[model samples]
Target: MKMVFRWYGTGNDTVTLKQIKQIPGVEGIVWALHDVPVGDEWPMDKILAYKEEADAYGLHLEVVESVNVHEDIKLGLPSRDVYIDNYKKTIEKLATVGVKTICYNFMPVFDWIRTDLFKELPDGSTALFYEKAKVESMDPEELVRRIANDVDFTMPGWEPERLKKLSPLFEAYKQVSEEGLWRNLQYFLEAIIPVAERNGIQMAIHPDDPPWPIFGLPRIITGQDNIRRLLRLVDSPSNGVTLCSGSLGANPANDIPAMAREFAGRIPFAHIRNVRVFDNGDFIETSHRTSDGTVNIAGFVQALHETGFTGYARPDHGRHIWDEKCRPGYGLYDRALGIMYLWGVWDSMGTSRKGVAE
Candidate 1:
């Protein structure tokens, strides 16, 4: 696996490219023009600026975490065609910078949902937490207010400006059912996959966080069967899945290692992390160690190795350890630690296979 780190950009992220360069196996940055609003064609100058920065540190800018799909596209509005065209243009621009994979999601309104950004764990280190009961009971607006006000930095999906019109966004999605959402997603893929294919960029869709419908919003990209359906939508190598472990692991039914093995050829990018699920349907992000969380991270890495995966992968999220006051899930210390744990598993698997062959 070719490891990468997600850097929000120069001023946006607390972790610097210098610090990311110090990580042993990381060779690239999974990045995007975060300031670029969704549905707008990315400015070539901004894209080049990121390239220049990564180039300065000898880090390849080959993977983008998200080129966020607009709600118009997800809702299948008439204006979606314009946004889809803009998406195509953005793909072309990113391709100019040697970006191999563009990760995007089709989830409506919120991209990912969590009850607490810094929920304290038993060990005193905090991490992103999802409380099912709390989400079900809370008002969407209240949840937005709490999340937006609490964080000093802008949350990717929960952009305060876009979410301010929560009532209308929810009302717009009311016309869309799960099947309708699937059809809309297929429409999007059919429109953009050809552009992505021509640009030599694989479009990977991140699975819905928690892998379930939240606050009555329809979530289609939830598991293996849905993923299979998604792949069939475009039926092209350019159309792929991000295969996020923490997102699908929340469901408990997703066989992540099997997914890695099955979709190995198609997946050009991966987000590998661990989350500990509880009897009460809650989960907290944990270290990348296999034993720390419910996800079979080691087995997942083993499957990647067995498949001879040369695609980009990253330590998705880490705990807020060492009193590091950084982004909720994206921190330096724990993520770097997670990377070492992943390397340990991957390298050991390589040695064991070599020994067996000898």
Candidate 2:
């Protein structure tokens, strides 16, 4: 696997590219123009700026975590065509910078939900926590207040500008069922996949954060069959998946390792992280180590090795460790630690395989 690290850019993130380069196996940065609003066409100058920055650190800008999908596109509004055209232009711009994979999602409103951003674990290190029942009964306003509570960092899905109009947004999605959302996503793929194919950029859709519907919002990208159906929707290699372990692992039914093996070549990017799931349905993000959480990250990487997956992969949300105060799930300390853990697994597998071959 080609290791990559997620960097929020020069001014936005505390973790510098210099620090990222120090990680043993990381060779690329999964990035985006976070300041640019969704559906707006990205300027070539801005894209070039990011590329140059990565090049300075001897890193490749290969995968973008997200090019946030506009609600218009998700809701299939009349204005979606305009936003899609802009999205195509953005893809073309990214291809110019040698970016091969675009990791975007089609979830409505919130991209991912967490009950507590800095939920304290018993070990004293804090991580992102999801209380299942709390999310089920969460008031939209309350959720917004909780997210908006942290003004320092902008949460991905909960754009303050959009969340301010939560009532209308929820009302808009009320008419959109799971089937309707699927059709709209298909519509988006049909329009953009050809452009992506032409440019040699893979459009990888990230699965819904919890792999299930939240507060009546329809979520389609959760299970293996749904993924299979999504791949068949456009039937193009450019149309692919991001295959995040934390997202799908929330649902215990998903066989993550099997899914990784099955969708190997089709997967252009991956977010590998572990989460501890309780019997009561609550879950919390943990270290990349398998023993620390429910997700078998070691087995998952083994499957990736077996599939000969050379695609870009990055450690997902990490715990806030060592008194480092940053984004709740994205501290440099634990994630850097997680990378070494993942590399250890992949390296051991290589050794074992070589021994067997000998």
Candidate 3:
């Protein structure tokens, strides 16, 4: 596995490229032009700027976390064709910079939903938390206001400008059912996957954050069955899934290691993180150690090793440990620690295999 780190960019992130460079085994950055509005073609000049910065640090900018799928595309609006064309252009441009995988999601309205950004754990560290009850009971607007006001930096899915149209957006999704969403997604894949294939970019769709419908929004990329269906949509090697552990692990029924084994070849990107699920249906992000959370961090890594995965992997959301004042889930300290834990498990697996062979 080729380990990479997600860097928001120069001024937008608290963690510096210098700090990321110090993390052992991290060879690249999973990045995107955050300033570029969704559906707009990513400007080559801005893309080159990010490339220059990563080049300065000797970090390959190969995996982009998202070239976010616009709501128009997900909603299957008439304007979607324009956005789809722009997406194709962005894919071609990213290919010129050697980006191997482009990660995007088709979740409508909100990309990911969490009730709390810094829910305090018993250990005193804070992590992103999802409270099912609150999500079900709270008003979407109230939740939006809370999330937008709480953070200084712009959150990926909860962009203030986008959420401003929450009422209309949610109303728009009302016309879309789960099957309708699937058809729209297929349309998107059919349009863009060919471009991705030509550019040697694996278009990996990230699963829904909670892996379930939230606020009555339809979510299709929640589990393995749907993932199997998604792969069938495009039926191309370029079409793939990001295979995020924490997102799918929230259900406790996902069997992440099994997923790693089954989808190993298609997955060009993996977000390895752990989350402890409560009996009440809430979950909190935790350390990457196996004992710390419900997800089998070690087992997933082992499966990757056995499959001879040559794709990019990154430690996903981590606890806000050491009093680090950073992005809710993108803090440097715990993520770096998570990387070390991943390396430990990965290296040990290699060692054990070598010993068995000998």
Per-model TM-score, in order, reads: 0.97, 0.97, 0.97
In candidate 2, where is summed lDDT lowest over 10 consecutive residues? Answer: 349-358
Q: After superposition, how far is residue 120 of candidate 1 from its true place, in Å?
A: 1.1
Per-residue alpha-carbon lDDT of model 1 for 264-327, expressed as tens digits? Answer: 7888888999999999999999889899999999999889888877788999989999999898
**Candidates sorted by lDDT, best first:** 3, 1, 2
* Candidate 3 lDDT tens digits, 1-358: 8889999998899999999999998999999888888889999999999999999999999999889999999999999999999999999999999999999999988888888889998989999999889998999999987787778787888778888899999889999999999999999999999999999999999999999989999999999999999999889999999989999999999999999889978999999999999999999899999999999989998898887787889999999999899988999999999999988888887544433211
The whole-model lDDT of each prediction reads 0.90, 0.90, 0.91
Best candidate, lDDT-wise? 3
For model 1, give the 10-residue run with minimal summed lDDT.
Answer: 349-358
Alpha-carbon deviation at 197 in model 2, angstroms:
0.5
Q: Residue 147, candidate 1: how far off, in angstroms?
A: 1.3
lDDT, candidate 1, at 47 = 92
lDDT computed for candidate 3: 0.91
Which regions of candidate 2 fall more than 4 Å away from where they truly are?
351-358
Model 1 segments more than 4 A misplaced: 351-358
| Residue 240 local lDDT, model 2 | 92
